[model samples]
Target chain A: EYPHVLLAHGGGGRLMHQLIDAIASTFASAELARRHDGAALRIGDMRLAFTTDAFVVQPLFFPGGDIGKLAVCGTVNDLAMCGARPLYLSVSFILEEGLSMETLGRVVASMQAAAHEAGVEIVTGDTKVVDRGKGDGIFISTAGIGVIEHDRPIGPEAVRPGDAVLLSGDIGRHGIAIMAVREGLAFETEITSDCAPLAAPVLKLLEAGVAVHCLRDLTRGGLAAALVEIAQTAGLHIQLDEAAIPVRPEVQSACELLGIDPLYVANEGRFVAFVPEAEAERALSILQTEPVSADARVIGHVTADGPAGLVTLRTAIGTTRVLDLLSGEQLPRIC
Target chain B: EYPHVLLAHGGGGRLMHQLIDAIASTFASAELARRHDGAALRIGDMRLAFTTDAFVVQPLFFPGGDIGKLAVCGTVNDLAMCGARPLYLSVSFILEEGLSMETLGRVVASMQAAAHEAGVEIVTGDTKVVDRGKGDGIFISTAGIGVIEHDRPIGPEAVRPGDAVLLSGDIGRHGIAIMAVREGLAFETEITSDCAPLAAPVLKLLEAGVAVHCLRDLTRGGLAAALVEIAQTAGLHIQLDEAAIPVRPEVQSACELLGIDPLYVANEGRFVAFVPEAEAERALSILQTEPVSADARVIGHVTADGPAGLVTLRTAIGTTRVLDLLSGEQLPRIC
Candidate 1:
C-alpha cells in the first residue's frame, strides 16, 4: 500500500525488493522476474551478461573517485558478478544546465581511465541536459554487455550449505569518504574511497578453475545488505564471523561519529564470493594476486540445510545478533 | 571556448555536437569518438549493435503515448537504424521520492506493453530514487542490444548520389502532442503522438531484400536534424521536396500556431531510409504493407556528387532554402 516512493525503496534493501517485485510482476518473462545482479542471455551459442546502473551520488567528485569512474566500475562489476568478462559499455549522461565544461571533461577522462584499466571499451553514449534546478550537477547511467567465458552457474540459487563466503578487500571506506566530504566532517586521518575496478581479479579466479557459486558486490546498503539479500534469495542461513570482516580504522571512527554501522556502509570495490569450502583457499590465493583484492579472506559460511532465510553475526563480545535489511532511509544516493 | 553547458548543448544541434566531441576526444579508441546511432561490435562471428537513450520528456503522459513507451521504442529504433534486429533491452529508472506508486505502475505497464510489441525483452533493469525536489517526476533510460542479420554495410557513408530518401510515416505529431499538453494550446482537432515500434516494418523491408544504405529516426531535432547529421557525416548534399513530405492538417495547424516548422519538430515512430533509386518502388511497397508504415513515401534524394555537406529544401512555391540544424533550443526534453 505504498503510495509514494520512499528513499528507502532505492536503498537496496527490503523496500527496494518490494518495489522491484511490484514493477516486475507486470513483465511477461520469468527472466525479468528473477532478481539477479545482471541478466544472462544466450545468443547463437554465446553467453552474454547484460547489466545497467544509474549513478546519482550528490557530490560529483569524492576523495578517490568521481561519478564517471563509479558509473563504469559499477556496471562492470555487476557483469563480473555474473562470471562474465566485461567487454563493452554504453554511457548516458544527464547534466544540469550551467555545469562547467571543465568538470565534464574531468569526469569523462576519469571514465576513460577506468574503462581502459578494466579492459572494456566505451562504445556508444547519449547526453541530455535538464534545467539547473531540476537536477543535481550530473547523473550517469551506464549499461554494460560482457561475454561469459566461465561455465559455472553463478547466482544466489547456486549457493549451498557448505559454501564458504569470501570477501574481497575492506569495506565502508567509500561511503565514509563521500559522507565526510558531503557533511564536512573531519577525522583524525583522511579517508579515501576504495573505488577500483575488480574485473581482472574476478576473471582471474574463474580462469584458475575455482568453483565459485555466487558473487555479489557490496554496494548501496553495503555488506549487510548483500548478505541479507543472498540469504533471502537462496533460502539459506549465513553465519558471519564479525571479527574477520575488514574495516579501515579511519572509516570505523567516521561511522562511529555519524552513528552508522560500518557493515551497512557502502564499498565500491568490494565483493562477496561464495565458494565451496574445499576451494576457498585456492580462490583466495588467486584473488590476492590482484592488488584490488589483496585482502581477500573467508569471512563466513553457509550454515543451514533448509530454507531459513536468516543471517547472523558472531560478535567480538561472544554474542549472536541477527542482521536484516535496513528498514529506514540511510545515506540516500550513496552510490 | 565553451566553459559551461547550455540548454542548447542538449538541443540535438551544433552545441550538442561540440559537447560530444569534447568528451569523446579523450577515449583511447576511435570507435567512441565517432558519433553514430549505435556502435556495431563483432563477438565471435556474431555482429551486434548497442545503443542507449535517456528519456526526460516532461508531462510523463501525453496524447498518444507515455514516457515508458518512448523508453522502449526509442532504443529499439536506434538498433533498427543500424540494420540490426532488435533483441534485448535494459531499462533503468530514476524516480523522484514523491512520485506516486500508481503513476509508476502505469508507466511500467506501458513499458511492458511496448517491449512486448517490439519483440524485445526487458531483461535487466536498475532503479534509483532522488530526493523530492532534486528530480523531475521520472526519467527512464534504456539500452538495447540487437543482432545484425542484414549483410549490407548500412551507414551514411553508404549513401550514394542516386539514392532515394524515404520517410516511414508522418512527422511532428509527437512534438506537437507534448507541446499541446504543456502549452495548453488546443486545436480544432486532436493531435495524437505517432510513437510506435518501427522494428517490425524495418525488418520486413530488410527481409524483403530492399537494399537500404542508411537509416535515421526523426527524433529531437526531427527530420532536419537526422538528415543534416547524415549529410555532414557522409560529406554529401541532400535535396528534399517539401510538398511530398507528409504532415497531417491538425499537426500542420498546431506547428503554425506555435510558430514552429514541422520539419524541425520531433517524431517518435518516423524514420528516413535511403536506398538506390532502382529499388525505391519495391521498398516503398513493402513498407506500406505494414499498418505502422502505410503512408511511407519517397520524400527526397541524395543530389550532389561532391561532398558539400549541405541540405536544400524545395518549397511548394518552387523556391529553395537551406535546411540547417536548429541553432537555438526550440523544445527542451521533448524526447
Candidate 2:
C-alpha cells in the first residue's frame, strides 16, 4: 500500500489517523490514541520521560510505510528505548507550497492512524507552508512524552559484561528498499521497507520482568551505530555472530550490488535489546512469536575483554572484524 | 558566545540541568524550574496547550542571542500567542560532527539562560549526531507544552470588525539585525537582535482581563505576515498608518540597502495583539510598562468595509497600499 507518500497523510486531521490505524497499527499496539498534547501517565515518585524526533525521509512513501507513520513510530520507539512507556505526541509539519491538498490529507490520515495504533494522540501541532524550492515535499517533526515507571528503569548504564544482545528480525530492509527505489535497481524480488512502530514488544519485555538492560531501535547507521552507542555508553565491548544475524536475500543482494554494508544500513521496525545471558533464550522466543519479529535472533554478547567501546563481528568463516560507526552519511536524506 | 551544539545538553543530566539554569532562565519564573519531561499544570478543567519549533538561524551566534536562546523564546512565544502559560520544553538537536565542545557548552548555557527568561524549563530532549555534511552546524528543535487557563482563547475566530491591533514594540530590530549580520553590513551603531522571551508581559495582560481577540508573534515575515494571517483567518480587512509602525534607524538603512522590504522581515521578540477597540488603551498602557514592549502602540484597527482578507497601509504619501504575505522567505535561516 506504500509507494509515493501523499502530503495529506501528514495532516493532523482524520485521514492521517486512518493511515496509522490501517498500515502502521499492524506493528503497534494500544495506549497511543489518547491524542493528548503530552502523554499523561502515572509513574511512581513522579518521573516522566519525554522525547522528540524529526523524520525527513526522502520520497515520503516507501514499500511498507510513509513518513507520517515513520514520524510517530520513530519518537515512540525512542521513548521506549529509554525504558519509558509511550504516551502523547505532537506532530509539526513544514510543507512546501503548492503541495496538493489531497496529498497532505492522505499523509495526515496516515499519522492519525499510526497514533491511534500506538495508543497515543496528536494533541497539538504546527503547520507552516514553505516556498516550493526551499524544502523537500515535506518535513515532519514529531515530539513525544512518556512516563517511565519507577520499577522499569533501563538504560545504557544498566548494561553488564555478561549481557546478551537480541535483535528483533532482519536488518537492512529499510535502507535497501529505499536504495532500490532511489537507484532504480531492479531485483528478481522486491524488498519492502520494515518501517513499523515497536512500542508493545518493549512493554511486553518490561512486563515479563526479564531484567533487560537497554533497548535501542536499529535505524540510521543500522546495527553498527546502535551497537556502538551501547558499547560507548556502557564502556564495554561487543562481539556479534554474523551468521546469527538475519538478512533477507533481496536486501543482502541489493546491498552487495550497491556496495552498501548491511550492518550500516537502516531498519525502522527492528530493535536491539541487551539482556542478561540467562534470559537471552526466553527473550528471543518472545520476540520470535511477535509478528514484527518473526525472524528475531541473538546476534551478540557484551564482553569484558578487549578495547572498551569496540564492536566486533564474527563472520561465517570464523573471521572477526570491527564494525565501526559510520563516519559519513551513506545514504543522505534516507531518514 | 557561539559554538557547535553537543550531545550532553540532551542527556537530561547535569549538563542539561545546568543549561536551563543559565541562559533559558534569564526571564523565567520559579514554577518553570521543575524540569519534568513535561509540565503538568492544574488549569481550570485541565485544559492544555502544546507547541514545538526549530531554530536554524545561521552563524549560530548573532548580535544578541544564539540559536539556543532563540529556540527557547520562539517556542515560548508560540505558547503565549495561544493564550497559554508556558510550562515545559523539550529540546532536540541535530548536531553535525566536528562541532567543538566549547561551542556546544556556550549554546547550552544560552539555552539555560533563555529558558529561565521565558518562564519555562528544558525538561527532556533527544540528540542525534549526523555526519559532517548532513547539516549546517547544529539545528535545534524545541517542543513546548503549556496549560491554558479557562475563558482565555484568543484566535482569529474571535476577531471582529472594529477590533484594534496593538504592536507590542518596535518592529524591525530583529529582522534588521539578522540581515545586517547575514550581509556583513556594518553600521556606525551596533544593532542587537531583539531575541528575548515575552511570557511575563503576556501573563500580566492576561491577569488584567483585557478583551484580547487574538495574538501573534511577529517573527518570520514580520508585521505584514502576522497581519495578513489575521486578516485571512478572520476574513476581515485591516487598515493602519505607516508612521505608526516603529522601526529603528539602523534597520531602516539596512532594509534600504538590501532592497528587502522591511515589512517582510522577521522579529524574534515582538508580537501583535488584536484587542477590543475600547480596551486598546489599557492594553497599550500595560505593554508600555513591560521591558519587552517599551514602545508598544495601537497600530491599526479592524475594518468592516474593505476587501476581506486584505491589509492596507497608509503610507507617508497619504495613500494606502495593500500588504500581502510575501511568498518567498525574506531572510533564510533568520529564525
Candidate 3:
C-alpha cells in the first residue's frame, strides 16, 4: 500500500520473497527462481556454484563474531549448501566517512581468520565510501565461488515426500545474542552467537556420499521460515517434532522473556538438511562429529504431497500448530 | 595521521591504495596485492576470474545509465579485462527504507537490459534494507565470475617494455557528464555518460587472437590512475603523447573551465590495452570497429624498466611532465 520499500523487504521473510519475485519477474531465469542458497551452473565442462550476500548487522561488533566474519561465512556456507567446496571469496566494503581505522582493522582480521578456517581465499575486493550519516559504520558484501564436487543436484526441489529433516545444531542463539546487546539486557549467562562457518560439515556429507536432497542454512527467518519455504518450493508437507528440536537453555529463556518464538528467530551456523530416510542416520552421525554441529538431531520429516505447502509443528503439549513464514520484520539487521 | 578513515580512503587514489595494502596485509595473498581489475585463479582443471565492486555513484539516475547498469557492466568489464569471457554476475542491493518501488523496478529493468546486452546472466542476488536516514536511496554491489578462455596471462605484470598503449575511446566523458549534472554546468549539448559495457570489445580482441599483454578498464581515477598503477606494478616507465589521446572538444572546454585534468577524469566504457608494438595498428583498427570504441587510438607506448615507475606525458607543445597518482580525493562516489 505504501508503494515504497520497508524494512520488512529485507527481513528474509514473506515480503523479501515477494520482492525477489517481483524483481525476478523483470529478469526471469530458472536459476534465479530455484531459490537455492546459490546458483549452480555448468560452464566449460566444470560445475560451479555462485552466491552473494550483503551484511548490515547493527552494532557492528557482537558476542561471537562481527560483520566481517558473517560476510565470509554466509557466502561460503551458501556455496556449500549447493554441494560445492568454497574456493574463493570476493569481499566489497562500503564504509562511512568517519569509521575508525582500528575498527576496520579488527573487522579485516576477523574476515581473514574466517576465510582461513573455511579454507577459502579472499582473492579480490572493492571499497567505496559515503559521507557520514549517509551510511552505517560499515556494510560488507561478499560473493563466493566454489567447485561442485558432488554429482547429484541439491536444492529444495530435490526434497521428496520420504526425506528426513535434520537440524545441525541449536537455534535462536544468534538472534537472541544480537537482541540482548541491542536492548541492553542483563542475563545471568551470555548467549553468544552461534555464527561459525558450516562448510566443513556440509562438505563432509557430500564427501561421504550422503544423499543430501537439500541443505538450507537457518538464517534471517530461522527454522520456521526455512521449512515453510522448502515446503512451498517442493510442494511437500514438512512435519516438525517440537520436542526433538534442540534449543539452548539460555536461548529458550531469552525467547520466553522477549515474547518471541525460538522457531522464528534467526540463526547463523545452524542448517536444516533434507536427506533420504535411508541415509539420514549416517548424515546425523557425520554431522555430530563436526565441531560446529555436535548437537545435530533429526527433528522432522517430509510427510506428504502438499500443493497447499504446509508446515506443521507437533508441540510437546500434544497440540499441533501450523508454522508460516514470518509475516513482517521481527528483527531488522540481525545479520 | 588521522586515526579514522576519510572519504579519500575510498577515492581510488593513494589513500585507497594504502588502505588496500593494509587490508591485504591481513589476508596476505599475492593476488590481492596484484591489484588488477580481477583475480584469476586455477581450480582443478578450470581457470576462473573473480571480482567485485560496490557502486555508490551519486545521482543514481545519470546521463546515459543508472546504478543498475553500472553495477552489471562494471563487474563484467572487470572480468573481461582479465581476458575472461564473463558468464555470470551476483548483485546485492542495500536499499534505504522508503525507496519507491517504482525506482527499484526501473533499476531492475536496467540491470536486465544491460545483462542481456553483455551476454551475462544475473544468476543470484541479495537485498537488505536500512533506515532511511542511514543509507542513500540505494547502493548496489556486484560480484562477477568468468571463464578464462585465453591461454596468455593478462594483467599489469604482462606489460612489457615494447608494448604500445591503446585507448579504447575518447576520455573524460563519463566523469564530465556526472560533474556537469552535479555542478549545474551547461554546454552546447548535454554530455551523455559513456557508461556502456566494455566486455564485447574486450572479448572480441581475445577471440581475434590479439596478443594483448594487459588490459585495464578506465573507471574511477581514469586513464592516469590506470596507467600509473600498471607502471608501478610492472616497474616500467610509460610515455604518453598528449596530442594522440582523444578528448572531445566540449569535454576539453569543460575540463579547462573546471581546471581538472581530463587524464584523471573517469571513463566507464574506455580501456587501455598494452600490446606488442607490431600489432598496435591492428588493435586500433579492431577497437575502432566496435561502436562503443569507435574513437580508439594509439595514445602512448611503454618505455624502459624503472623502480620509480614514472609516467611522462609529451605535451602538444613538446613539453613533458610526470604524471603521478592523485594524492587525494578529487571526486568521491563517481562510480
The candidate maximizing DockQ is 3
Every candidate's DockQ is 0.82, 0.09, 0.87
User: Sorted on lDDT, highest at the top, how do the candidates line up?
Assistant: 3, 1, 2
Instruction: Give candidate 2's whole-model lDDT.
Output: 0.71
| Cα lDDT tens digits for candidate 3, A63-125 | 998999999889988988888999999999999999999999999999999999999999999
lDDT of model 3, residue B44: 76
Candidate number with the higher lDDT (2 or 3)? 3
TM-score of model 2 relative to the true fold?
A: 0.70
Ranking by DockQ: 3, 1, 2
Q: Candidate order by TM-score, highest to lowest?
A: 3, 1, 2
Over the stretch A1-335, how does candidate 1's per-residue lDDT look in tens digits? 78999888898778898898888788756666557789989988899999999999978998999999999999999999999999999999888898998899999999999999898999998999988887888888999999999678899989999999999989999999999998998887889889988788889888988998999899988999999889988999999999999998888888889999989988899999999999999999999989999999999999886338989999989899999998754688888
TM-score of each: 0.98, 0.70, 0.99
Weakest 10 consecutive residues of candidate 3 chain A by summed lDDT: A300-309
TM-score of chain A of each: 0.98, 0.85, 0.98
lDDT, residue B154, candidate 1: 83
Top-scoring candidate (lDDT): 3
